[model samples]
Structures are given as C-alpha cells and as structure tokens.
Target: MTDIKVDHIIETDVLVVGGGGAAARAALSAAQAGANVRMAIKAKWLTGGSTATAFSELLAIAAAIGHADERDHPEIHYEDTLDAGRGFIDPELVWTLASEVPHRIQDLIDIGLNFDKQENGKLVQGMSDFATYPRTCRVNGVTARHILVALGKQIKKRGVPIDENMMVFKLITDNDQNISGALGMNMETKEITLYKTPSVILACGGAQHIYKHAVGTSDMIGNGYAMAYELGIPLVNMEFIQIGPAAIKPSMTLLSGPVWKTKPILTNSNGENILEKYVPENVSIDEVYTEKVFPFTISSAAYYLDTSIQKELELNPTPNGGVWGIMPPGSEEIVQEKIPKTNGVLKAKGIDVFNDPFEVALVAQCMNGGALIESPDGTTKVAGLFIAGETAGGLRGPDRPGGNSLAEGQVFGHRTGQAAAKHAERSTNSANPEGKSHAALEDLADWIGRSKGKQELNDAIVSLKENMYKNCLVIRNEERLNDAMTYIQELEYSLENGEFNIDQENFSAAIDFKHMLTIAKSIVLSAQTRTESRSCHYREDYPEKDDANWIKSIFVTQQNGEMSVDTRQWPHHRKSEKSEVKL
Candidate 1:
C-alpha cells in the first residue's frame, strides 16, 4: 500500500479545534488579537457541540456580576467553587476563573448575548442547589445556546475561516514536542486536510459519551482528551463526571428543579415509591427531592435520590428499563418557565410534564476533567497547545459549581486566544513548515484503508459503554470497577489482535472507539485508585470522603505507550487574604 497524502493544506497563525461556545469565543478572540485563525468542527459551526444541545434546567453561566446580590463578589464565588471541589481543585485556577468570569460575561453581553434581566436593569440571577448567592445567569434556560449564537455572530463578523464537517484526527508536533499543526479529515469526503500553525487550542469538549446513557453530542467522545493523553499530557480529575436525571423514553431532556418541583415520585414498574427505603431515616426526603441540584452529588443529600433509583434498577429491571417519574399535577407553567427547551422535548414526545409519568434515568452529563493546564492562559504541558471549556481541567475537582463550566470557557477562551497569538508571533519558524502534519495524515489514512468493518467491533463499543455506566457512574464498587478494568483490557487485546476494522463509513466511530476505550480505562483506573468517596465519584466500599488522605488529585500521563498515575497536592494551602478581584 502507498503512503496516503494530504489532499489539502491550510496555514494559519492559530488553529482552534471545536465549534462549541469555547471554540467560538477562542476563534473570535484570536481574530480580535489580529491573528489569522482557522477553526475545524465535526459538524456545523454553532449548533454542533454540547453548548447548542444543552437541555438541562436553566443552563448556567456563573459569574459574580452582583446583579441579584450586591454582596456576590468573586471571593464568594471562589469560596463556593472550593467547597464544590472538595479540596481537589487548584486554588489559583479557581481564583483566576472566578475573577475573570464577570469580564467574560460582559464580553458576551457586548457580543449581543441577551441575558435575562430584572425590572431594575440588573441581570436576573438564580441559584442552583449549591450556591452562596444567585450567581447563575441564564436566558430563560438556554444560556449555552444564546452564548453560542452570540459568539457565532462575533466569529462571523470577524471573518474567521471555519472548516465545517472536518474532524481533527491528531495534533502534529515537532521534534521538540512543540505543537506545529494539526491533521483533520472531512466527514463527508473522507479527505485529509493539514493545518499548519504554531498554536492549537483544544476546546473539543469532554468524554461524557463514553457511557451508554450520555447527554452530550454523539461526537464528544473525548477526542481532545485522548489526543492529549497520547501526546504525554497529564490529565487530572478523570474520575469525576457529573450525572443527572434526564428523560429516557420520550426524549432526553434534563429533569431539573422545575421537573422535581412537580413533586415527582420516583417509582418502580409497580408504582411504588422506591427512594423512601434507601435514604437515611434522619434525612428529609422532601428536601432531597426539592434540592434543585440536578447533578448527582455526594456532598449533598440529593445523592440519595439517585442511589435509591440505582438500587431499584439493580433489583428489578423495569418494563421501561428505567425508573418512572410520576410528575405531580400543575407543573405545566413551571416546566415552561424553567426549561423552555425541555418543554419542547416533552411536547414532541406527547408526554406533558403536567399529565404523564415519564421514564427518567441517571445519565452521564458533563465531564469536569481533561488535559491539565498550568496557567489561566490554557497552556498545556505540550508547548504551543492550549485547552479550554470541558477539554481543560484545574478549576474543577470532584464536582463543579453550577455555572462555572460555561464561565470557565469564556474566561480562558479569551486568554488562550491572546496567548496563542503571542506565541505565534514569537515563534521563528514561519516560512518553511514541516511535513509532520502530512505524515500524521498518512498514518491515519493507512490505518483507515487496511481493515474490513466487523459487527463484533460495534458490539465491543456498546459493551464498553455499558461497562463504564455499570461500574463507573453515579455508584461504583471495588469489584465492579475491577471488572470494568478487565473488560477494557480485553478490548485492548482485541485491538492488538486486529479483530476490528476501520472502514471509511465507520472511520470516525472506529477512531472514537479507540479514544473512548482509552478514556474509559483511565477513568476506571483513577476511580479504582481513589479510595475515598468524594462528590460524583462515589465508591460503595469506600463510603466516605477522607479529606486527611485524599485531598490531593490524581494525575495520569502516558510514556512508552503506558499510563503512569501519580498524586499531587493542591498548590495553595489557604485562600488568599486579599479581597480585591484581580481583573
């Protein structure tokens, strides 16, 4: 077989890989910094990633704008973030994110993001389950969509070139382990394109789709995480992922505060309330149900709500294959007001939240982990490579505050864009580019050309998702986590034996299979190592958060095709004494 050649080559000062809110913000910021930027997306520009499809209770963009509460400052926001993280996040990163978020929110407003406001002209802020004040800013619930639309308009106005339907396959690095360019393949034509640039920003989002019950775009299979891991970048917080109840049968929409406000009784197939039996007798069940915390959190009592449901699922497999949500009456207005997008989903399914008991289950939602970055500028261990959004982790630990994820994207996206431009300007190699990008494409094309697709490969992928959900999701145990490891190792063995094929039609799926497998293994590995139960990572055997011993984070990196996992203490032992915000 001949070496596969790149069909097209594009040169830019910086490359942003993703089309979500973070990528859009980064691209626009880079262009504003007078950098020639090119962006590649797996789908269309604005509506392709998780930001566009987010359908939970009001998608939050947390910023201490002091709209609702004048006392809601960055210090309070930073404290709340630390409390959510359970001593696992870097204090500096959290401080940086909280400090800059208000400015980033203002930037979004400048770009035409119409945030909901009160009659007094201040932005209307609301509270999630865990908040010192109302810091979550939203637009009737579609915060992500509106943010994307606003950033999309800015990118369009700035004239940044966007390559749609182009899936970035790998990052090309020079001999010094410095990122030089990237290789991508057009989804429609399967032709390879090489992007030559000094800087690459990874906003490719998270690996929530690694589970069978996932809530993000299908394309978010941790491509960024896998590429960074393969390139020897250490990833932190792989064990921590957010899960929440979402509609299962009618359609997948977030069953958030409003849905729970209807006093939905979680029942088995026989219509018996299941949660009463599992929750502690001392805990108030009403408060747990009305906690307004969508994500299953170990730090709060609401976690019992999900644990009880999981218990029921194990004992009796329901006819619908999920726990039934018997929503109380008079919820129509609340549903419409809180989650307008979910209202559409319910209407399309013909199951009114006011009338019917819909099937709801705990589904994997947001990933709070990714390639570790050392600075607020989103600089990764790999030079010339940066990351933001869910693709970067440092500000979040065992869990995240309600709106911090989206806000982190905006804050760091702006910094990364400017940083990439400066790096591009400082780099000396501009006239003559290397062929490593083409070489990477040739390797990928060679793998794609050789193999015949197999049904077993697809089945294996399904099994991977099932194993992760069963063992590594909301509830986990030592035995089950070990079982997950075995299954992942066996799948890896199959890949080594050439049992799977990379046919053109299943090319992306096959590639995603590899990424998901790696990411799943890492999650299970990290979960198994962390003996204490903290936040979303609940271990049944280790049913306590051991702050004395488990306050540090586990960092995983790869060398010689093997992963090395180690622990690192949080940099700061105490909060900063200064009360003034940095920005």
Candidate 2:
C-alpha cells in the first residue's frame, strides 16, 4: 500500500466545519463556553455558504417577540411551526427553537446586529407565508448576510481561529466510532491537514446545489450530509425540499414575498399566460398570486403557478430555460415601496421589472431534512459529533414556515456549541487516531490511482444536476423518481469503476460530485418511499396527502455499504394531536 502524508496536525477542543452563520455562531458559543474552537471553511470568509449569499429581497428571521403584534408569543409560534411541519417535527426541538430564538436574536442585537425598526424604535415584523402572525424580522432583503456579518464580528472579537479554503472530506473516527478528528485539504494548495479534536460540529449547510437551478451557493454540495452518511448517521425527511421561483435571466435572485405581490404576468415561450392554463377555473390567477410567497406548497392554489412555470420550461423552454414574467405598468412603484433593495439590485443589472419581461424558473431553495439529531443540542447517535443548522434534520418537516431556517440555525448552533464544549470538557483524551487517518487517505489514494478512463467530471455533474431538477423538483412521481434513482446508481457505479478520469485539477470536484450523487440518491429514494403528495414533495401518481399512513417521516441511512430507507412516526405525534391548532 502506498503511503499518503498528512501535512499538518492541529488540535482544538471544538472544531466547526463550515463558514456560514451556523458555524460562526457555534464557534462563538463554544469559545464563550471556554473551549478552544477553530473553524475550517471550503471557501473564503463571507463568500461561500448559504448564510452569506443573498437569496431574496427580504430574508426574514422569525421570532415571536411581540414587537409587531401583541398577541404573538412562543406558544403560538410553536403551534404554528408544528402545523406547518405537518406532524413530522420533533416537538422538543421545535419548542426549543420557538422559545430560544428570541434570546439568540437578542444575542445578535447585543453583538451589534440591527434589525429593521419602525420610527418609534419598535421592530418592523412582517408576516411570512404559513405563519399566523407578524413574526418575521428582516434587515431589508439581505437578512442572512447581516446576521453572518454580526456573527463573524463576534467570532473575531473572541479570537477564534478560522482556516479559509479548507475543504473537509472525511470525518476520522476512533475504533469505537467516536469522532476523533477530521481530514481536509487546502483548496488552493491541495495540502492535506488533520484536525485532532474531541468534539466536532457539522454546520456545512444543505445540498441544494445538486439541482441545476438552485439558490444555494456552489460550495453547498452537502458536505455535512455526505460526511455524516458516511459515518452511518441516519437522515430524515430527505424528500421534503423547498422549491420556489427565482429570476434567472438578468440576475439570479429569489422572487419571493414582494415579487409575488406585483402580480406579474407569467407567460410561456409563446408569450401566452400559462398560469390560466394550469390553474383550475375555480382558482383564479389573482388568488394564486395572493397565495404564492416563495416555495411551492400543496396546501394552496399557488402550486399551479409553479407547475405552470415548470411545465413551460419542460415543453417550450426559453433560451434561459424559464418562463417569462412581466411586471405590470404601475408595479414598479409597488416594487420600490415593498422591496427597495431588490428594486435597486435589478435596476443596477439593467433589468427594469416594470418594463421588460424577465425569465423565472422553479429553483431549489432549501432542504428541510438532513442528518437526524437526537436532541435540541443537535447530538446524533454518534458520540463526539454534532450537527446544527440545515445540516441537521428532524427539527423541520414537509413545509417549513418561511424564516424558520435562520432561527433554527441560531437556536441549534448555540445549543450544539455549548453541548459540544461540555462534551469536550468531560472527554478523556485517548490515543491519536493516526491509523484511521491513514486509512481514509489510503481510500482516497486507491480511488485516484484506479482511475484509467477520461470521462469529464463536469459533464457528469451537469447531467446529475439536470436529472435532479427534472425528476426531484416540486412535482415528483414514482416513475421519474425511480428513473432518477437508477441514473444516480449508475453514476455511482461508474465512479467506483473508475470510468471517470480523476486528475489533480479536478480532484476536489470529483469528491463533490460523489457527495452530490449520494445526496441526490437519498432524496430520490425518500421521495419515492413517501408515495403521497404533501408540501414540497408532490407525487402525481398519488396526488393526495395520506395522513393515516404517510404522516410519518422517511429516513435514509447507509448500512452494510448499501443505502436503506425506513419510516418513523414523529416523536411527539400524540402530543401534537392534543395541541393541534386549527387555522
């Protein structure tokens, strides 16, 4: 066996593997708890993760602080969250998020983060889709960016070390299956480093980029999901993915709250209003527009709006593979008033929404499911390893209320950080896992050495993305999902057989493609197992929500080197029934 050398070995009490808001907050909390924390990111600070990327004109952070509405409270938020989750949420986690997000928001404010406020110094909370009250707060349209910046400032002030452009590919575990450390490579220099830590936090975000059209940054290719799955962690609710409309032509920004209010004219390549064709006669286009916010959910008539755009793209796709959406004559005034930041962004890009028609497509937004956690502290079955933010699953379900993601990140990030710190303090340092690290490197070396063909990795990635977008997007069915699964399996086989060339220049991309393939297959398998239409996961073959049978969440896990699927009833299902809130 050929030996692969590790360039550096560093030790920390807690290692956070991500650059987003969750990772930043986790590092801050761990440091505040007196743990020596370090951060490693695949991209430069503030440019790689979903938290730093601008998705919409108004990215809301939901918390029931009663600043905007007196009736709003944590209990209402908890009930609303359960209702939106469709009985698939972890009630304890939901309560933790609902009750603790206000404190986390206060922490952000204490660290110099300012939310939008009214003239009287009260917070300007807005109503997000599926929410019962005005509970979402924002910083104009770029809420995530501002939150990340604030968290970054705190991380710096605490003197937590951050290693930029370090792509972690393997989680090194001891013979007992406890997390010992992690192995990563410097993207720029290709130098491998081993992180020796008693505790590790996985906050690497979601795998939305596996789809052709997605709102996530390119680096969010399911690093956390892939690593956890490799370590035999179960992922839940993988089928429930948020798909929504986004401008694809002039600029790739989410066409959410304010954009829908414009009541834009949606047309196909033939310049015909396509919404009228898809929307039923009983449901008017006006009603669809009113119900539409961002994601395509089955509970409202807005589903037809997204279906119309998707069908148009599949049938008569424009040059940009999207349908045309033209804002009305007087809607520019509304845009300016409602989404001034987005309006300026479009104007700067020479896209006059009121005058010219822009291309809009159904883009993958967020993954509601990921690595399953056992507690609010984001602890998985695996000891010494934790997950938070979009990387951790079971906190959300079928349809997440808008702005809940930001709150989840902060809430769980804080909990996971403190818990990991405590775990580190209690842990006794065992012998170094140098042999485990070598085994991981040997596996990587073997894969690279066996490559004898010349198939381009980029082409395979494009095909995977296109396939995922077509079959696994908002509208899904048995046949298409099976086909996608088959294709993914074939790709996996090809990769293992070394049909695709592995070169130094594309090594990192090859690793990312492998992770994407795994994630995409998990999504397809989960979507196929559900066999019902619910929230973002719509099965045309079933076309109905089966609460009696399908209310449970689907779980995917890697067992015996093969992927398996199973189902589990929500932990708080009975309790949820007792406290069910009727809208």
Candidate 3:
C-alpha cells in the first residue's frame, strides 16, 4: 500500500456509485430512511447510462399489476421469471423481485412516473418476450428514461448531493473486512476525492460493450465487475450474456418487436433467406421472428435467427457490417404508428425501414451475470457493501426475463438502499483507517502514471473488442475460446508490465479498456469452464444442456492474482416467495 495525499474528503452515511435509475432510486430510498446520501457519477448528471438511452416498448418493466388481466399476479410473474431464467436464478432474490416489483412500480407512480393509461383509468400494460400475460407496463417506448426522470425528481426534491463528473475508482475496506468508504477522481479537476461512508451501494450497470458490436451505452464498461473481482467478490453466471440481432445502420437500436412484427424478411445482399440454410430443420423463420421478439434465449428458436444473421454478415459482406432486413409491403403505416422512434431515427439517416432493406446484425444486448449478492437485502460477502442493478448477478440466471432488469433496479435499489442506510446507522466506523485507501490510491496513481504517451491503449481496446466479437459472441467453441483466452491474458500481462504507452488525455478510455478486458476475461473463463450449452451460453462443442453435470451456475473469483472458477447447484428446488399461487 502506497502513501498518497488525499485531495478532498467527503463524509456521508451512504455512498451510491453510479448515475442511472438504480443509483438514483437507492439514493432516494436511503434519504427516505433518514440517512445522508451522496451519489457519484462519471458522466453528466442523469445521462449517458443504459437507463437513460434504452429503447423498445418491449423493454418494459414487469410487475404483476393485473391491469390488463385480473388473473395476473405476483405468483404467475414469479413462475414466468423462473422459467425465463431456465431455473437457475436465486429463488429468494427472484421471489423478492417478483413479489415486490408491483409495489415499486406504485412508488414510481407516486413520484410522477406516468405509464400509458387506459380509458377506464387503468395502466395500459402489454405482453412482451417471455411473459404468459400482459404484465409489462411502459410509457410509449421510453420506460426506463421516464422512470429515471421520476427518480431524479425525487432525489432532487429530497436534496441528495449528486457529484457529477466524478469517476469512482475504488471501494475502500477496513481491517475487519467492512466497507469503510470509497475513492473517486474528478474528471475535469483531476483531483482525488475520498468518500468516508459506512455503506456503499454499487449500481454501476453492465459491461456489454466489450464486444466490438454491442447495443450498449458508450460508457457501459464493467468497472463495477473489475472492482468486485479486485476485492474478491465472487461473480455468478459470468458467461451468460444476451445476444440478438439489432439495428446497425440507422443507429444500434434493437430491431425486435416492431421490426419483427412487420414480417420483415431477413435476407443476404443477394436476397437469399439464410435461416432455412443454417438453422435446424425443426425451426422456421416465421416462428423465430414472431416468438423471439426481443429476449435472446437458447431455449427459444429465435436465437437461430441471430446466429443466421451473423453468419450472413460473415459470409456475405453488406454495407456497414450489417445484413439486409427487407420488410413486406404496408410496413410504412406500421412504422409510423407502432415504431415511431425507429421511423424517426432511420428517416434522419436517409433509410426508410418501410421501403428499404435496412442493415441489421447480431449485437451484444445485455449481460445476465454479475457480482453475487444476498437475497432480499442485496448485500455482498463484504459487510456494508451492497450491489444493485445490472452490476449484481444471481438475480438472473442463464437467460433474462424481459423487463426484469428495470424492475430489479427499482426493487433491489429500494431494498439495498434501505438496508445500507440501516447498516450505516448502526455502524460506528465512518472514517477511513490508515492505509485503507492506500491500495486504491496506488491503482489510481498507476493509471495516471502509465497513461502517458500511450496511444496504443486505444488499439488494444479495439483489438480486445474485435477478438471478443470473433471468438465469444453468438457462436463459441473450444478452439476459438482458447484463442480468446490467450489473447486476453497477453493483453493483461502487457497492461500490468507497462508494455505499451497509454494516452494520458484519455484516462477514461484507458480505464474502460482495462475494465472491459477484465470482464471479457471473466466471460471467456466461465464460458470455457461450463461445458454445456444452456440459455445464452452456447458452446458448439457441447451443443446440448447437460443437467447432470452443468446444471449449476459458474462462479468466478480472483485469489492471489489468479482466477478460480467454481460452480454451485441451485438451492431449495427453486422455490419462490409467491409459492401460494399454484401454476
């Protein structure tokens, strides 16, 4: 541990790291629980994260509100969620979320989140992806955006201190393994700031953009994942990431639901339907397009569509690294009404989705794995350290249930914030002990020191992304995965050994490159260890799910600078909280 002078010291009861919907909701919950909370964000306040820019009405938040149908309830939602996860989810956590999300949605409504309402004064809910009923509630196409707006207003009204442009670098722990505080750097001022808090909530989202082609926000690198790994927190299902065919040309928006509803024929540049050629004879193009609207699950045949599209891109080069998606006639009216956002975005790019063969490709959509947390409370193995949102794993399993991510942010965000605040109130150690922040400071210093004359860092990032897309995305096998592991290990070695000059001006990019590479290593390592195809983690070598051997979730943790991959079977036969409702 190196001795470094501190620039600024901030004392709070709770420190929420991130600026997305989860972070905001956590802050609000903490404040309501009568704790002083401070939120640190790397970007501009209330912008640039996944929650701010997510699209698709199908990306709706699931809460069994029973609006569309009276039979819809939490128990049914729980079963749907469990089925969507393929029975590998944390039963208690999934239960808590499925039971509590409707209440959280009501909380959002109280804070001015206006869902589309019906004429009879009920919230207009719709069915999407994996649900058996219309339980998803949304406001047009931008559900998460509006939820963020509502939560932001609440945080502002409660007078929570939000420090923008402050990139949190490390989580500080005390001698007893308790979270003492956190450290961050001011991006604009270039000054280090120490946050002395008893509780820290990590809502730092996912690291999906490690692949070259991804439908993630620009800053959606896995800093939280790296921090968790560095601090020895075990991650679950690290190999399971949702992948799907998305719009590439007119913007990287998801080309599901609306686009698929138009009966769009996915073809090559030569106007050849390739799904029939590559997918199993049992799967059909119409069924894949209609049934697999958004979520990319291996259980569903829709994944074949994504694989076929990717193969088309690789086999036949199209404009802008995308394939042709030709919609049938009368698509113009459907585009204007159902997919106004798609129409407007494509219209600006001089491509009419209704009349033209828009470019689309298989892209990295969401990560279903992250740092594992205890059920109902969102606490990690480390005391006073909690995780919420996409940063926390185990709530999801091999595949994702549509809209659960947003609901999770609200549900666990509220629970984690309340839990952290209560813990902070009971704790006495509010100050950072001597040398507690030293290791974190050393890393920050290392990042600063090595960031000089390092233009190759950008090249390394590009290479990492390209290699991940080539070896890890959509299709995976033993040979390609091994090659990826070798390349990544070499890059990690180079970064540690200072083999290349890093750009000082682009500190964020350098950090992003490291974090992305770290998560990519975790994904590849977990993927290699799990020798069976299940959910989103498909191995061509092991083409079928092996329940006898591979039914357990893979856990990846770091020990003595080396990765240790392990697995644990789902406990308690996947019993949910709402077990009263019979299927």
Estimate TM-scores for all models. 0.94, 0.96, 0.93
Compared with the true structure, the alpha-carbon lDDT of candidate 2 equals 0.87
What's the distance in Å from true for residue 583, model 2?
Answer: 28
Predictions in order: lDDT: 0.81, 0.87, 0.81
Give the alpha carbon lDDT tens digit for every residue of 361-401 in model 3. 77887788999897678998899999999999988887677
Taking every candidate in turn, the Cα RMSD to the unseen true structure, in Å, is: 2.5, 2.8, 2.8
Candidate 1 lDDT by residue in tens digits, 294-354: 6787867788888877777777647655788755666666656656666677878887666
Q: Distance (Å) between predicted and true CA of 396, model 3?
A: 0.4
Clashes of 1: 0
Identify the candidate with maximal lDDT.
Answer: 2
- Rank the models by TM-score, top first: 2, 1, 3
lDDT of 2 by residue, 264-340 (tens): 89888887889877888888888898888778888888888888888898998878999988787777678777777
When 2 and 3 are scored with lDDT, the better candidate is: 2
Model 3, 127: alpha-carbon shift in Å? 1.4
Off by over 4 Å in 1: 280-284, 329-345, 430-434, 445-455, 573-583
Error of 1 at 95 (Å): 1.6
- Model 3 RMSD, rounded to 1 decimal: 2.8
Consecutive 10-residue window with the lowest summed lDDT within model 2:
574-583
Clashing pairs in 1: none
